[model samples]
Target: MIISSPAKQLNSKLSSQEQEARQNGYLFAQLVRLYHTFDGRPGNEYSKLQDAIACVLDKIDQNDHPYAYTNKLVMFIEARHALRGLYLSPDQNKLLIDLRENTKRTNLNYVYLSAIDATSQFK
Candidate 1:
């Protein structure tokens, strides 16, 4: 005999919409951890945030969520500027529009889950 739990059934039916519903907060937290990792290590924290964004840009398609993703990125850039209060350009909004769109990101949920697991180790 075999029985599946409701949660199991729900997990099996998750589509891109479900994935889109869940934003990448774990990844964002990991990035923030990395950004603040060098508080006294003598390097530019802003550059570290740029590197984090670069890593994300390498993995994510621009069409992942367009306006939503761009807004999130803008927030990241804003967070990085909190200390300096610097007025600067994110330079990622236009690229988010221009980058080629993918019809599907088959592994986005898996990626997010992995991020959650990876970041959990920090606790």
Candidate 2:
């Protein structure tokens, strides 16, 4: 038996979207690492992480690329979900919730699924 690959046009589109999607994935991974490193503790590190996330969001907001906007919104949602698992204070939780809501209000699409799951579905 033989299986055919996706069409060239589909591959091209997926490749372009994948570039931004991968960046979003990386940001979420970084947030997860930070959450692990500072679980249940409020300190400079936590503040720094929050600042970094804000900076990323600001950069995304300034970006005119549609893919960048979608990627950034997805990253924000993923990061917020990852942060929720960590033992964060009420204030921290509120911050994440606010971030999620703000990102949701953006024009970008925020469809999210595990990378592996998405890839498998495509296959």
Per-residue lDDT for 56 in model 2? Answer: 49
- Name model 2 segments beyond 4 Å from true: 1-84, 107-123
TM-scores, each model vs. reference: 0.31, 0.31
Which candidate achieves the best lDDT against the true structure?
2
lDDT (10s digit) by residue, model 1, range 3-92: 999988888778655665444443344434434443454446555555645555434343343333333444455555565564443333
What does the lDDT read for residue 60 in candidate 2? Answer: 44
| Each candidate's clash count | 0, 0
TM-score of 1: 0.31
Q: Please write out the lDDT profile of model 2 over residues 1-123, one tens digit for every residue.
A: 866567877888899878866655544544344445445556554544455445444444454433334345335534544754434556545545544553454544333324421211111
Model 1 / residue 117 / CA error / Å: 20
- How far out, in Å, is residue 23 in model 2? 24
